[model samples]
Target: MSLKASDLKVGDTHSERLVEDLKRTQLVQYAGASGDYNPLHTDELFTVKVAGYPSVFAHGMLTMGMTGRMLTNHVGDGRLTKYGVRFTSQVWPGDTLDSTATVTGLSEVDGVKLVDLDVVTVNQNGVEVLKGYAQARID
Candidate 1:
């Protein structure tokens, strides 16, 4: 499902629901898989009492990964040449997330077509949690 540069424009977009009612179990699993066991992510007691957050929150990387999945699903496997993001807000249990990738640029560099995308992930309330950009090879 490679994107064709000729078929895309700067404002074209693709979106996906990344998660629904995010669970603490999913946070713990991501902690184990990514080796990021910060109490802010998995320790509800510490997060509330000691860390002073409302609750254990999702890892920024977890949200970023979900956003990346949206990008890959839109751009095709192994097509990404660059990707980067900034975590804008905390994601907590029970939050549903939706991600979007909007084409920002299209060009042919050295005869290879490429597309630049602006990526964003927002929670159920429409608060952005992750924002980034990606560049990928296209058909």
Candidate 2:
């Protein structure tokens, strides 16, 4: 049988994470893949001198990806119908980024199960760098 959000309870925990180092090479790779070549992400010298950032920064989407990964890994096969996030802080190349998601709401619509998650991403400094809601359409 396909998984359903109603199968998950309020206290059902689905995901956990460890902070990952945001590598400079991955930043460049993401820039290549996503076509987001803003100097704040790729050009360190430009970032430091012109953009005034301390060093190369990761794209906000890159970190948001971690949030997506958490839900997808745990929820499986289901498609997220709505996903949006707020970028709270910058992620430097060496910054460790951790992400997790928990089921916070569940409902059904026209025989389809739906789930909502309180997703978040934080750094090693124990600061919340991203916060958002993720919704999945389950069978």
Candidate 3:
């Protein structure tokens, strides 16, 4: 459900499953769609044999996009005013990621109701993979 200014409290929280067992093929598709075919994302052999990572990992943008999807699901279309995130940890294959947002502030700006949310995304092991904030118009 979309949030209204009156419906939000400082600690109100919402979560959504962002990804289940993130796949290499999905990473390749994201690379193709976003033109971010960095070898680190698409090349497992290179990453493991050369770069020394156990396997290829998901892109930060992919995680951020999933967080965006969570916000959109909560706020509906065209309601977001500002959103940004910081990548905190690597997201690996076979990890389930969940996006969560907590209401942080509520105010009226020029007669428009605004809601501020603290956003975070965590992997299956409960490690924060992304941290961010989003502001949206709630009418």
Task: Report the number of the highest-TM-score candidate.
Answer: 1
TM-score, model 2 to reference: 0.90
The 10-residue segment with the lowest total lDDT in model 2: 11-20
Candidate 3's C-alpha runs over 4 A off are: none
Judged by lDDT against the true structure, how good is candidate 2? Answer: 0.80
Clashes of 3: 0
The better candidate by TM-score, 2 or 3, is: 3
lDDT string, candidate 3, 61-132, tens digits:
999998999999998898999999999999988999999999999999899899999999999999999999
Residue clash pairs of candidate 3: none
For candidate 3, give the lDDT.
Answer: 0.92
| Winning model by lDDT | 1
* Alpha carbon lDDT of each predicted model: 0.94, 0.80, 0.92
lDDT of 1 by residue, 98-139 (tens): 999999999899999999999999999999999899999999
lDDT per residue (tens digit) for residues 5-75 in model 2: 54777756655564466689998998999999998899989999987878988889988876787777766
All candidates: CA RMSD (Å): 0.8, 1.9, 1.0
User: Over all chains combined, what TM-score does candidate 1 have?
Assistant: 0.97
Better of 1 and 3 by lDDT: 1
